[model samples]
Target: MDMNASPVPKAVVVGAGPVGCLSAIALANLGWHVTVYERRSDLRAGTHHLLAPNTENNPRQRSINLTLSARGIAAVQAIDSALVERLLHNAVPLRGRMVHHLEGNTTRQQYDRGGHCLYSIERGLLNLILLKAAAVVKNIDIQFRHKVQSVDFNKNTLHLCNLVSGQELDDHFDLCIGADGSHSVIRHHLMLATQMEYSQHYLSHEYVEIRLPQGVDSSGHEAYLLDPDHLHVWPRGSFTVVAMPNKNKTFTSALFAPKSLFDTLQYPDTLIPFFKTHFPDLLSLLGEKRLVLELQSNPRSQLITTKANPYHKGAVIIIGDAAHSMVPFYGQGLNCALEDVRILSILLRKEKDGHDPSVILRVLNHYSETRHEDLVAICDLAMDSHLKMRHSVATWSYMIRAFIDNILYAISESPSLVDLSETIFGPQVPSWSWLPLYSMVSFRPDISYSAAKKKAERQERLIDSLGVAVGTLGLGYIIYSFINLNRLF
Candidate 1:
């Protein structure tokens, strides 16, 4: 399989999540006969998965609301510009981070000098669009309720068991993609096949979904408890709560807490008192009775962060959550997975021996090596932000430094900071060598995402010091001139 020269082959993608659906979309566009196997039923069935409150108070309601920042939008735009625009309709553009203090005083920090908004959207809606797009492609077929049980990478074949009927079958493909997520069967098979170093850590934090109702405001468009145009974050330090609005006048809220805190929550009786005390006025719209019931009934989702040394074998490759799973605090989980679809398509089209499974493995290894640093950085940031969200604003020292940092972002995001903002928002610049942070985060044309991040950080330090030096020099010159005038007089 010389990757430098062949046509598209039969590709198998496991998982029907956003990442998996996007992979199927990309592969089909690249002219491959792509098949996607998912364990869940089709999302387009429109069966309301959300049991929380809605405008109609209809118990059957739903939303997978997520903060879709520039990086995510860029990735989506790269794949299909129209889909990006279509998704924007359901999204509320957030101009900046709206920090909600316990006292009710708020601060708005813009992300871009031009006031660029990070779109917030429903996750399930995005998945449906991707799935529908894949359905339209003649090269793809999506099989729901088909669970992949195992893979024999050596033989270029996969073993799958039907999730519904308990029927087992074996199939072969030129390339197999494990976009199945953290507990990917493909990733598991790859680990057993070769010498792969894998590490997984379950963080101390936990997340449980909460609800906020939608009501008509004084003006009459749908009204929400929190501002709809912004991403609402209640940073409390040890724990935090955030909300993203949906089309239904209601807002989907999540509570992130330490295991200890969640474990202590048992009955509805204690739940309301605690929420009202901790979150204060937030419970006004969300009623104490409902909050307590949700805390007791809703499951607390665990956070699992992981990394795999190499992502490929003779016929298999793992992408999305399978390759690197991080916490959802950053809201990049689904978007990052979609980005993988784009990257994979680029690689498949470029590889000369496109049909050869062996070549695919080599490419997969290169992809893993290149992506490692960025994945690690995001995972760590997600973990650290828990502290930032819950407590940093409360500390004067931390708040001051953060304010300065925000100012820097405002400058960097400026068009005057053209090269700077582009780098800050993502990794796509070609010429301007950015500091590691800039490079990894935004300017990534030349270097790998990891190396770029390193450069962006180093650049930030020098840039900050340069400002200080110029200010000091100006002050010194003014003082010297005044002394000379005084002496002359």
Candidate 2:
């Protein structure tokens, strides 16, 4: 039985977001018949169609800009380097974070040494590009405005409703993938089919969007009011505001605060003063009138962290936010989701060589087993980062430790030092090769999230021991100097 002569498996992908589109492209590349179903109309039809104007009644139109790191870029590149390059052309590279403090004081924290950067891109635009790429594939079919109402995993059939024509339809496939985000219909049916462990936890904080229009520089050319090369953050003790630049020269900003805070600022009188007291520097960039309008108009969206075990069962598999929806602090949610497609694609390709369609069950099981730990690791990291971004970024101790970690990273990168260390300390010191937690998570595509977390824990312990040793030596030296001075006197 030659597997090469076997017919390609038909795959149904729910949702037309970036993850779904990427999955379709990957499946098509792997010689699968792919069909993508999207509930919303095609977004690439008109200019600013996705970017709905800030209205008094509706506010959840456009999402915060996506920060694309090495993990995501690697995933896209794996599918098509040309597609990745096209996406990068519209991205604004962000090297680090610019922390804005009270009294107009600002501090810059670089994410990595040696010029590593993350790209900021409009989410809608990126989705459009991905959909376009998927559309061109001969083996892929994209159906817009078709909502999946229910799924029967045992039967391998989908109950879908056409939003445009108001017609219900049934679609059958060899495999059904749910990338329909946190509230997924496929995930719901999977829960009914099997005992799937799932949990959704929401943070007390909620966020609202604020748009910062482009301004003119001294030369009368368009320029960014804030540093365009860095993600701008105004971190308050209990809340924070972040802004990311777009190619259109505007910055999409979000104000994250407690629900109680949002409740109090329902009117202009309270909202205007709140911004004045907490984020005074933003007044010039986002004028008082515009800020008030956006605040009053924009909906306050909650921050949620969702986790599910056994992302696949039978012929139905869940990926992206449907599997593990996380807070956006670590900026790895989308990256991890994209990586899911890449990994699953690899597994399916490997299984296809067996020429047995039943091998998909084993492949999906393997995927769920292996991908769970990394998903959990990243979810934990994202939750922890909320505190680090809002409060820890302002502390001197955090900065000092970051500096020390970076120095060690620089040393590890030196070929001579690495060679000498390997010769002296041998394999025992291989684990000591300095890689900061941020670098491991954001910059290194080779390391899995779980492995990175474990390595970080070990490095943290080493740093703690080194800190204690250095403190003790300083104290001993001071005591010796004092004793000698007393004898002289």
Candidate 3:
């Protein structure tokens, strides 16, 4: 160590989830001394031991499996390619959605024609990987079981209590980041300190987890009960059940339905029958006994969509779920959170003299200003996607539009078209770009969420106009034929 070295900037991060841990790593890489506070104990130490002995037999003790798309992969790759590789190693690639219909029928809808895929990874495993990576960083200090009590933004300090020792401590820092998730204490204090406009709305629907055990295949090898390469969905009009494969050969499924529907199944007797009527195929696989046990044991979790304006006040900034929490329909919650870290790191790196305390405020202000629009777009998309997944995917009109979109994408990416256009027109002919809304949101990290929404809206309007024109032409031809027949009579 050099005696003339400048002191590193200090940062306090609340929460040690994926977003929080990644934020700590980003800050540490930027020459900031980071301290991370997590409310729960170190999850790297198996979750089974943390639960009560009696509760160890519960199957739904984990979170919904996370879907990792291009946005998330790019973010992790930006941090460290090796980290991304490790995460992918444990992931199951899902190329499309397998829509399960009534009478045991199924149809597969590919996400894109170009063979792009999203990886299904367990949330707990991903968080553990991030935590382990953060642990080895020289400048990061991770303190599990340190629950944040409150934040004093005026004094640039955090008040926390250690869960194990039952001791309280106050820590001052040059900057504070709140990645503490939906029920963030830091965000709570920031609201009190500043006029932070915030609103939270819960969907009428609720979800419950169901474990689909692995079964032996014809080859006498363990395999997923359903197609592991696609995300399986049993979509009813008002209710839906989706499943994603795990590395352990089993599938983690979630049942999303209206509160009214969930309420009707009050007893174990009603539960199995309801599954038999709605999801007959799943009922056979899950077994009546297992379905009843899961419904009786697991609690239904409400889906919430939260939004806030100006995610920063002074030197305190909020990221991930603390800033915007959306429903899981779009599978972009974690991806968006990871993008938050990536974007923030880029902005900080651009500020060459960002080590100064005063420069920190400018970096945070820029982040909040630029990030809010994208967050709003994604939240709205997630809400709208719920309806599409439940009903629209099975519609003929939706499938036709998807087919048209794929054709457009293929044309846009064709090298022959580019060459032909350049030769026929000029050497400076610009390359054409076309993408489906899903591709834009899930695969294209270069496009902003707001931009993607605008592009999709434009495409929708064009399709609607074309449909009307085609309908008018058909109606005019029918009227003409009727007039000719009447004249001949």
Candidate 4:
């Protein structure tokens, strides 16, 4: 029953975030001795933390940007099917993105024609689910307020400081995983082991979480104005406000803008005015009094972008935000992190099984070298999607072209296209360790990424040609009919 029992190694995981919790559970499932160390006090005591908060006294809120996309759902389902059902029941199924414009025009773009939906769920809800799942694993032990101060990789030991008791701990384990997020102590130790190429950049964008309470119509009842099936967005070029429905019949909303914009807020200043102007419907939902308190009280988080080579042999590995952190505009940050766990877990089972310690080390290293491209691809795609959502929706050319795409897609039938959508969203594809989204999503047996990419190009070309040909034929038919009518007259 114990997959790791050959050596019967003890594994210590740093951080109690979603990725760390999942990693601890996965290893414990495979019979590894998993002990999770977290610096935060018992959240059981209702302890909530915002990485950064304002000095002003205001009612604080708990909110995070998370989109459960197809790939993310698959990653989650692979780990636990029960969780998938529970999450689906709790989440607001986002059938598509609802783009709201300055001129009061709204557009809906569907991810699939069959009404298949991704979801918008609160990050804290999802994390709570993962933590609860991990809590049930028999071999997993969790130590709250145990902050890791240093790591000794050569000796495979850790020096930890207890945040609550002001105590210190030195412990040994077979593996050390730094799921402690972007500012990882374990990752810091890995820098001492190898020349790790790492870069972290903070985006000009800053995010402030707000709430859009479900309001009632003129009748004495509560209601959600917008379609609960969609993720709502008011893209204001450089700044934006987004509303995603919650199970509580409320929608958690966030406003993202530059710091300069927030700094220019005066007494009775433009913040509320701006919201009331650009997001009239939303401002009405989140009352003016509550909006002021939220902006003046809640935390303003800096958007960070990070990239790193995650493996330094068997001594260290980083998952989730610890490796790559992108702006939440694309809504894949947490999803990508969960997907990382899926990849490493599969790789550990496939390549490390029955291998010597040294052999396992080599396998881990190989997986690291291979996973970079997919990381980059996803990171890039996430970044590009922001442009399409925030700015392109307002462009005439963008609207026209997207409509054309919808029409062309309607006329075409590609097994690969259908398979591609399913595979990307399906939970059964092999974790190729490092595979393209299309290849991994579609699970094409022999199609290399280069070939798949070329095919995508050809498909696009064919769709464009069909659109042109059909338009021309329709025009010709119209002219001929007009000539016949004239002759009859």
Candidate 5:
């Protein structure tokens, strides 16, 4: 250590989840000393089944695997490209969704025409990877099992309790980041300090996890029963069963339905009959004995959507689920959380000269105001996606619209039809400018959530008008032909 070295600024990140771990790495890279405080013990020391529910500590253990897309990759790549590569190396890439119909037939729908894929990675695995990365950073110090009791933004202090030793202490920081999660202590403190508006909504639907183990192939070798390249879905109007591939030859599946429906199927008699009626095809995959066992064993977790306005107060700011926790329908919950760190880092990088009290507050306020719009857009999109996954994906109109959108996108991406593409879908000034809504939201990291929603609205309106015009022309032709046939008769 040089005697003439300038004192490094310190930042405290609450929660050692993926978002908090990434936040710490980003801050450390920005020449700040970071201390990551996590309430849970080091997960890397635990077994692969880290998502096992613990009703005593965490009732809603996130068992659903996360879909890592461009937004998340961009964030990680911004800090360290090597880290992104390592994460994806362990993740399973999914290109499309295989929809299982009532008649035991299946149809696959590609997410994008450009062959972009969503990486399916377990939440614990992702957090573990990031935790390892954070561990290697020289300036980052991770203290697990140190729960934050309260926060005082006014004094820039945190009251932390050591769960292991039963000791309590106060820690001060130049900056405090609240990445604690949906139930955030720092967020509660900020709410008390500032007149921040916050709202949390629990959806009527709940989900329980199920497992699909590997099966033997013709060669007698273990293999995936379903196509591992695509997400499998059994959409039944009001409820759905979906599965994402794991690195192993197996898959983690979930059944989502209304609370009322879940209650009715609590017993084996009702549950087995219900599965036979609605999800008969899936029943074959998950045998009667195992389905009942898993369904009964796994805790049914509620889906929650949280919204908070002005996610910052003073030198403290909240990110990820702490700020906005959306349902996992769109699979953007984790992606958006990762993007929060990227956006915040960019804003902070702009103020490179110095971060005084006022300057930090100013930057935080701007981030809160601008980022809120994008967060709201994604939260609403996630809710809408839930309905689509549960009901609309099985409809003809949905399939037709998806087909048209993909065709338009493929035409736009073709090198030979540059001029034609430009005419049909606006100017091709920016790459992926003519992408469909899903492509823009999932594959194009450059487009913000709010911007994607706006563009999708415009595209939808145009498609609706074109449909009406085509229908009118077809009706006119039929009427004319009918009149001519009557005259001949």
Candidate 6:
């Protein structure tokens, strides 16, 4: 059978966020008829709820701005390099983290020795850009305000409602891709069809969105209240405040704390005093009036970590948060989700030589089996990073180790030296250089999450051995000096 003469496969993508939009784009580019169904109003139309000021009564509308790294850009680049260029033009580059101390001090921790950095972009803005790109594609149809009520994986059918017109309809597809996020309706339906091991854990902590407006600098020109090149962080032990810059000179900040602490700060009297004590510098940046207004108005959202095994069943598959949702501490949730699109695209393209329906199923099954290990590694990594962001980043011991490791990395980068991977593992491991865990995850798209985790563990063991060797040498020198002093006496 001629591949070109075969009927084009049709795919139904659930959810219209960055991941969903990217999925639609990739599938369409792969010669599939793609339709994207989004439950919310089109943010591109300016009617989306996120455009309005977030209030206490509003649904979860606040945007947790994304930190775009190598993995995410790789996905977009696969579809269109121009789209990557457009998105980065609108984003502010985050060189590293700006750690604000309690004692009125700040420190910068660069992400990598090689100068790669993440880009900070608004969530709604990113979605709009993707939607615009998808709109231009001839093979894609985007349906906004369409809610998925139920799904039958075996039948490959979906029951959907038009949220705007109150019309309900049933749609069928050759393939179904679920990107509807952590609380996905498609995921719920998938569970009914198969015994998918699933689990969700809600952290005791919650978060509220806050805005830091531009302020006049010493020269009287309006400027960013915080450094635009860094992701500003106020790590206060069990709680933390993070701020990411926007192109408009303002910043979107979030306060993450225990729900018990949130309960105590129900009003200005409590909230103001709490900020004054723990985050005095940020209090001044936000100002007393605006601080109280935003704190009281913004909804407090719970943080959740979701995991599911075998992300596919029959012809249906789940990607992004629908399969594995992690906390934002590591800032890889969006990056990882976008990477799913990239990985899936590679697998699906392999079967393009022949339009065999069975080949598609085999590819999906292979994806589910192979992709889970990397996703699980990242989900666990994200959970562990919460402690690092809130506590370890501020500790003196952590700083010292990071400094020493960075120095070692710099030395290893010399042209005269052998590849770090070969030096550590063996000559057969190829020439990948050593990097810090943050660098490996964020800067190296070629490294899988599982490989990065395993490599980081190996790096830690090597460092421990070096520490012991250095300590032993110092002890031997001290003993010799003591014996020589005793002989002189």
Clash statistics: count for each candidate: 32, 0, 0, 2, 0, 0
Q: Which pairs of residues collide in candidate 6?
A: none
Query: How much is 162 displaced in model 3, in angstroms?
Result: 1.3
**How many steric overlaps does candidate 4 have?**
2
Query: Which tens-of-lDDT digit does each residue in 118-172 have in candidate 2?
Result: 9999888888899888999999999987988888777888899998899999998
Candidate 2's C-alpha runs over 4 A off are 1-5, 47-60, 352-355, 414-429, 478-489
lDDT of 3 at 55: 34
lDDT of 6: 0.84
Best-fitting candidate, measured by lDDT?
A: 5
C-alpha lDDT values of all predictions:
0.69, 0.84, 0.84, 0.69, 0.85, 0.84
The parts of candidate 1 lying over 4 Å away from their true place are: 1-8, 46-64, 219-221, 393-399, 406-452, 459-489
- Stronger candidate by TM-score (1 vs 6): 6
RMSD of each: 6.2, 4.8, 5.0, 5.9, 4.3, 4.2
Instruction: Output the TM-score of candidate 3.
Output: 0.93
Better of 3 and 6 by TM-score: 3
- Scanning candidate 6 in windows of ten residues, the lowest lDDT window is 420-429
Candidate 3 residues 351-372, lDDT tens each? 8788776788899888888888
Give candidate 3 misplaced runs (Cα > 4 Å).
Answer: 1-4, 48-61, 414-432
Error of 2 at 162 (Å): 1.5
Model 1 alpha-carbon miss at residue 405, Å = 3.9
What is the C-alpha lDDT profile of model 1 across 324-366, one tens digit per residue? 8877765667656666666666666677766665677777776
lDDT of 1 at 460: 60
Worst 10 residues of 4 by lDDT: 50-59
**lDDT string, candidate 4, 26-60, tens digits:** 67755678999887654444434322122112336
- Residue ranges of candidate 4 with Cα displaced over 4 Å: 1-7, 47-61, 217-221, 352-356, 407-489
Colliding residue pairs in candidate 5: none
